[model samples]
Target: MPTALITGATAGIGAAFARRLAADGFSLVLVSRDETRLAEAAERLKQKYGVAVDVLPADLATDDGLERVEARLREGVDCLVNNAGFGHPGHFLEVPLEDEVRMLKVHCEAVLRFTLAALPGMRARGRGAVINVASVAAFFTRGTYSASKAWVVNFSESTAAEVGDPKIRIMALCPGFVRTEFHQRASMDVSGIPGFLWLQADAVVNEAMRDLALGRTVSIPDPRYKAIVAVGRLIPRGLTHRISAMIGRK
Candidate 1:
């Protein structure tokens, strides 16, 4: 069975990817900050899918954590899912400097390091996939979160071009308003968001997997989001920023 490694594997999109990959017969290595949660998630996946599950507890915000994960990636896995991330509840100006820095470390630095580490192994094997989980926020100007994700999308596309290997796929998976613990954990109020805008994590993962298989360098998982991103691109950046700011006001 192919081995897959997923960061932030205890919940939300990471957990969804774990379930889907497990069902698809991938032996999994799960990484998360919470050791207990990781163990519990591994046990459940193993019981339900009969697939081998290993858990690695590491907080991606630190150097030691990044080095540890990068070391594992260099060891080789058929697939790597860079899914660890979080959101800030306050405006960019209101958020603390350290918080913003931490966001960049996890969203930008860790993704960069993990992908670099994973690719050499994939290149040698000539067959593997790396799915970097970005967000629809990338298209707008919602602060560091969007800015960092935009970097992720651009990085994934540029890396894919540079790699120029059809069998070694690198893609950015962008989802909109996912119904996960993301907002809750960030303490962001979602009353302003419409019910229709919410997306289930499993559905997002399903579309993402399909897009990866189809050789897409960027996967916007839903038709609704695809249209939204298309429209956002056509509108002026100022208007897009205002609209995005209004959507999930605290």
Candidate 2:
């Protein structure tokens, strides 16, 4: 069976992906910062799916942490899911410099490094898939979070273009307001939003995986979100920024 390496596999979309892939008969290597949770997740998946599961605990924000994951990537995994990321809510100026730097490391540097490290082996094999968990926030200039997601989007698109003829597939999965620990962990205020507007984690992961299998370069999970992105492109940048700022306050 093919093996999949997934970061942030302890919770949210990452965890959902783990379950889905396990059910599809893939063995797994799960990466996350929480050792206990990681072990628990791995154990559950292994027991539930009868597939081998390995837990790798590392903070993608730190160099040592990223190096640990990179070392594993060199082992020639078949699929890589760069799903580790988090966000902090506030005006850019109000957010601490350290937090922003850490976000950059986790959301940007770690992703780029892992993809780079894994690409050589994937290219050599001529058959592999990479999924970067981005966000519909990439369509808006909400904050540094959205900016980082935009980077993921462009990176995946560029990679697809660079290796279009090869079987190496790179895709960005962009889902809006996923029903996960994301809001609570980020301390983001979502008081005004209705619960129905949020997409479930499993649904998002399922759609993304389907799209990846179909060789789509980018997959936005919700139809509403796809419409939002479509409308966003037609609007002027200034208007988009203003709308984003308004939503950020809610």
Candidate 3:
């Protein structure tokens, strides 16, 4: 069985990926900051799928935490899902500088470092898949969150191009309004948002995994979101930023 490593595997989309991959017969290495939740998820997967599961509890915002995960990457990972990230739902200036810096570390630095650490082993093995969980916000300037995710989008695209010849696949999985603890954890105000706008975690992950298997470089989970991105690319950046800022204020 192939070994799959997923960061932020305690809840939401990350947890969904864990369960789906386990069901697909992938032995898992699950990473998250919540030790209790990680252990519970590991136990559940082991029991349900009869697959080996390893839990690595580490906060991705700190170098020490990332180093621990980097050590595991050296062992070689068949599928790497860089899914650990969070955002503060407020104007960038109003958010604490410390929190902003930590967000950058967790969302950008950790993903970059882990990908670099894992790539060599995968490349040498001549088979690997990297699935980065970015967001539709990547196309808009929603704040620091969107900026960081944009880095993920570009990184995955560039890396995929560079390594495509070797049959190594790097994909960015972009989803919109995923019904995960994401917004709740970010403390986003969604008072006016309708229920039908949200995509479930499992649905997003299922599509992402399918696209990865098909060697797609970028996987936008929702067709609606894909259309939105397509339209976004056609619009002027100034207009896009204006609309994004208005949306951010909501």
lDDT of 2 by residue, 1-250 (tens): 9989999999999999999999999999999998999989989998999999998899999999999999999888889999998878778888899998898888889889999889888888888888999899898997788999999999999988987845888999999888788877888787777777789999999899889878899999988889999999999999999877766441
Superposition-based RMSD of candidate 3 using all C-alpha atoms, in angstroms: 1.4
Q: Where is the poorest 10-residue window by lDDT in model 3?
A: 241-250
TM-scores for all candidates: the values are: 0.99, 0.96, 0.96
Residue 222 C-alpha lDDT in model 3: 81
Error of 3 at 57 (Å): 0.5
Local accuracy by lDDT, each model: 0.94, 0.89, 0.89
lDDT of 3 by residue, 38-156 (tens): 88899989999999999999999889999999999989999899998887877888989899899889888998999999999998999888889989999888888999999999999
- What lDDT score is found at residue 68 in candidate 2? 95
lDDT of 1 by residue, 1-250 (tens): 9999999999999999999999999999999899999999999999999999988899999999999999888889999999999999978899999999999999999999999999999999899999999999898899999999999999999999999999999999999999888999999999878899899999999999999999999999889999999999998988987887876657
Q: Identify the candidate with maximal TM-score.
A: 1
Cα displacement (angstroms), candidate 1, residue 119, comes to 0.7
In order, how many clashes per candidate? 0, 0, 0
Ranked candidates, highest lDDT first: 1, 2, 3
Off by over 4 Å in 1: none
